[model samples]
Target: MNPPQNPPQDPPQDAQLQADTVWLESIRRRIRSPSQRNPDMSWENNAADLIERQLQYDGHRTWGFVIYRTTYASDADWAEFLRRLRFQMEDMFDYFNGRDILEKFALTVFEDRSLFDGASTDTIRQHFQQWSSTAYRTEQQQQQLEEGSGSGGSAGRVSIGRSPRYRFAVQVDAEALHSVVHDAPAPPELDTTKKGWVKLIDKSWYLGRSEGKSDPLEPIKGVAEEDVGWMKVPYQNVMTEYYTKCRSPNNWSLNYRRPPKVAGSPFD
Candidate 1:
């Protein structure tokens, strides 16, 4: 008898869907296929997988990662950098447009040891020592970490600084761009006409400034009214653009003014 004819081979150009659970729980039973099979599939499978997993596990969320680079020549430059950094931190949690996250994890600053040829990890740690000791591990700061306001463990620690090339990692718990929470806060009342004691209803707007306390207005550092327009910007930003005409080498002037309050309507 002729040798059993081999099963008709799939043409090299034809796509085959092999059953795969290589990413099970990530995607239910999914068909495994070569990228060439669906060259026309326009969607990003990886991103779609992430969205699916986030909704299933993390409960529909979008996260923001803030990263920037700077080279500091002196302590003055470092001080200015910190000033702007603190302002951005406050704005991220306090402003209306900033009320995006459900959580914030940590911020880390790392020195680019690669900038220095043959720089060892020990040398980098030593270079970063001054900042680490002064900022992250003070008695009150440690206490705050214990109390849950600051990042608590080693994960919350800022490792490197005092270097020419510095990179920042600001983590936030902001919503995904496509989430549909039933109780998302309303956009800030853009009607600048009326003014009075408007109670802050959006609890997400405050980071920790008013936590556990019932303050009628959120206790946030105020930015100038004109500066409110800058709220939506975070990633890929030029810090100096916002710092212009604003004092530096001193504190970034965040004169915390409460958002314009509107009188509650009687008809409600």
Candidate 2:
């Protein structure tokens, strides 16, 4: 009888650990490197300038105290808000930069008073001070923020709610602008066309775009009030697969400016 063969063994413990460490480092580098994800990021405008420009816009000056609603618990809510505001600020930069409207447009963030306990310009500036003082604003600049808010007469008041949200005080060519595009339809398959359906294929739900004849049993559009089953999939997962299949890359030609009164206002 032939000798029995042994299965291949994994590397020794130390070797295996080192291999894992190296693999993790590689992933970290890839995530940190903007060029890996956004090819045009090298030429993109820095985020700090974007925030300042947006704050300086005229709309904020005229529309004092634009209140926004939030869902964050009061515990360290300011910190959470700041972190998200930074991300939104980055998005604003990417959107405007892609549209070639860097100078002609601006976007600003306002603190919701419901969360901040009637935070005035000074209160909001103080929060920014804790995290972004040296980077974005100085103590002197707090006064400036007050001047801008007071002069414009537009401060963001806060509201408490289950749905956490923020406001983008958008300005175009020194005018208080909401969005350039108003009520633009969502994904056609999701709204107008009976083309997409949330169907289980291979044990996973998808916002799939149907072909030829539509799936009558699984309609694509939203049903009146309740959350749609397959549409309930996490946004990130849906976008990941959707973008891979239908990658609409941003370029100089894309317009990211949104219309005013895009959603019901808390101020209203």
Candidate 3:
């Protein structure tokens, strides 16, 4: 008679650990080279390079500015432009070990004319600082409740709490500005302004918890609620995935699965 066959067995724990290590290494490689994942247009790349260079040398500064010009024929085009900008900023922040610092970042959009006419960066900066302070307080309160000994109070509070990320401010409606395209080779009469001017500043003024802490380099999973108000339908769905599913550590691993894209989503 043939020898009795042995029953099948699960893989050894060591083998599983080795597989996980390999997967994590792959993710690290990807994070190091974001350009390979999303190739930017020539102008877009230039803009991103400018911002990255500024951060590299003057990252300690509380605020900075960049001039951006884009040609958008429709609302969809505008949305795509904003989405690309978001991704580029995220990559730059991660590259400089500013992932945690990103929470204190704020963006303000402006028309070229306003910069030369009457808009004040100081006023905008002050408002953003106030908003960031309120958000910080809210988060602290929630944390305290989560750590409380009260049974019922902390019960179903096991749910993950929300925290503020990026905040944006604009004078006019985003959709209304879709038709205002700026493709001029040179900036307008104002030497310091471009058709599209964006102010990127730190609301925390380098006084937050992330002041000296460095978070692990990783991809930004979703856009903040304040940013979603400026995005279109497809981008909104992307934000949903980021807020709901991508927040978990398990989703950061290589085995994480992305949800199906919405009908017209530009993302893969």
User: Which ranges in model 2 have alpha carbons more than 4 Å from their true place?
Assistant: 24-67, 70-140, 143-167, 170-268
**TM per model?**
0.21, 0.22, 0.25
How would the candidate models be sorted by lDDT, starting from the highest?
3, 1, 2
Q: Clashes in model 3: which pairs?
A: none
Candidate number of the best lDDT: 3
lDDT string, candidate 1, 1-268, tens digits: 7887788776454232222323332343243431222222212322222222332342212222222222323445334444444454345334222232323223444435354233322233344444434543342235435556554443244332221112112211112111111122212312122211111111112244344455344322342232221122221121212211111222222422233422122211
Least accurate stretch of 10 residues (summed lDDT) in model 2?
162-171
Order by TM-score, highest first: 3, 2, 1
Cα deviation at 134, candidate 3, in Å, is 30
Q: Which candidate would rank higher by lDDT, 2 or 3?
A: 3
Each model's lDDT: 0.28, 0.28, 0.35
Model 3, global lDDT: 0.35
**In model 3, where do residues sit more than 4 Å from their true spots?**
13-15, 18-59, 62-65, 70-72, 91-98, 104-110, 113-268
lDDT of 3 by residue, 108-129 (tens): 3343443323333334445555
The number of clashing residue pairs in model 1 is: 6
RMSD of 1: 22.3
Candidate 1 is scored at a TM of: 0.21
Report how far off residue 170 is in candidate 2 (Å). Answer: 9.6
